[model samples]
Target: MDKRPSVLVIGDLMLDRYITGTASRLSPEAPVPVILYQSNEDRPGGAANVALNLVAMGCDVTLVGVIGEDAEGELLLSLLLSPHIDTSNIEADSQRPTTSKTRIMAGAHQVARVDREIASDVWEHHAHTFLRLVRKMLRPESIGGHPFDAVVFSDYAKGVVTEDLVRKAVENARFCGEDGIPVIVDPKRKDFRAYKGATLITPNVAEIQLATGKSVGSNEEASTVAQDVAERYECSVLLTRSEKGMLLCDKENGLKTMLITSRPVSVSDVSGAGDTVVAAVAAGLARGLDLEAACRHAEVAAEIAVSKPGTSIVTEAEIIKREAAA
Candidate 1:
């Protein structure tokens, strides 16, 4: 890890379109929900948000993901380009549409929402193209020929993070082990099998419970599952327990778990907090921070993320201010 180390973000890219309005009156046309009557905002989401957070934190970031050539895709690219993050790794697929999650908010409350996206597995040809794009982005010429200090896998489980890509990346990271590049995964799947060799996997309480088939009624249960995952997957884990905080377990460190509490905050929206967490951890580790230090940094970043509205992007200054106060 080095100061100002570069990071690479891979997985799904999506647009979070928020339609905010007051819902005082119910819609007669639709029996299901009330209609919103105010303007809205759009933001980057999924893997794109992870890159945005990294860029906002002043880390040189490269985003590799698939998006359609549709309007949403255009918006996603435009948003990424406006920031300091690099979009050279973004690949367009004509066959699929760019994923978008639209939330209709009535003032501070969510009224109704709809998701316009696809969840099919990546076709073989497109997978190959994405692999090529990844290889290109990792090349020195494209990204300064320097190896990324950390690789963040922000999996929304929407299909961009294919098995082939995961295998290739893990193998590459293992080969560069002494260089000490940490590969972090923000996993969505119930099974941690696919992300076997990742340096760190961040899964929420529910995800951990489902993945490990262990009931998580208490911290004791969570601790047990954390160690179970670490030993079974042969990797470290940072289990996020929402209000209960997080637990870090490393196989090398045995079954002992380290608990880190999150900074209390008035949560406005938790849409992209996971992305922020993954970004902060990756950035911290890449900058040579210890695992505990990195998890704390991520927790602070997540607190900032939750305080903002919608799929908000946490800035470096905000994180620094929170850190100072903490």
Candidate 2:
């Protein structure tokens, strides 16, 4: 064993269903497209995928979030139990429906997709209950009586990660940080403000544009946006620009910055790249790495994830081998 550290992942837990077939003709019954074949199934997604990546990287992971008491939720629970993950913090709700996204693909290309979820604002009562649960999970006596090395907020803008919930998570991490725990966030739009005290925040190009209201046209532009966000939120920021690579900025450390380009790889799909980045960052923090080193590891892990098909994960050994080859 490499003495991997324990990590806590919290946010949306979803099921991703992919329909793969051949689209050889148009529909005769309506003015629309048609598929000539059929194949489909479900896979872990959102924060679940993040946790999966953490486990693949030899980290002990515990996922804390909500899931519906439906068949999909049952399947997800079963899958997690099969792994070494500690799911004692996962809450199943009969009132809310499980979040699921279905993507239709023809060969390696995605054609269309549908999302079945509830995005309306969560009730205050539910938010209070969720926060209480989270605090309990982070207490000194929970989860083998040892505090987690880090916590990750893998928000997908779903209702599960409400503003109040995010704020509570930050406060909890602040308390943990006094004792040397790190908090990393993979944030979405509405709750970005809720992650003010995070140790690190990872947002993609489009998300950075939306969050910072800046058009990143060049390297300097990327640095400026990162600096703005880091200054505003009082935390380090990492901007992942798909093919263009990534940029990191930390205001406390003389506002240092580093840009990492994507390694050469066979392109197949871009799904779950953000999840992989957050996963790698969480793993790195747990293993006693600084924000820059964690972002570098995450960049390489995301490159590996994008090269594979459909919300795939990257292993630690695979990242080491790829970096060595590079």
Candidates' lDDT values, in order? 0.82, 0.82
lDDT of 1 by residue, 156-248 (tens): 888888767876777666545455468899998867899998889999877887787788668788788788889888889998877777888
After aligning candidate 2 to the native by TM-score, how far in Å is the CA of 155 from where it should be? 0.7
Q: What C-alpha lDDT does candidate 2 achieve relative to the native structure?
A: 0.82
Clashing pairs in 2: none
Query: What overall lDDT, based on C-alpha atoms, would model 1 receive against the true structure?
Result: 0.82
Candidate 2 lDDT, 1-326, residue by residue in tens: 56668888888898888998887777889875686567886789999999999999988888877888899898877767645598887877777778889898888788889998887654566667778876775655433344588888888887667666666666766555446477788888743677787788999888888877788879999998788788878889888998888998976697788788887778788888899999998898888887888889998998899899998879999999988988
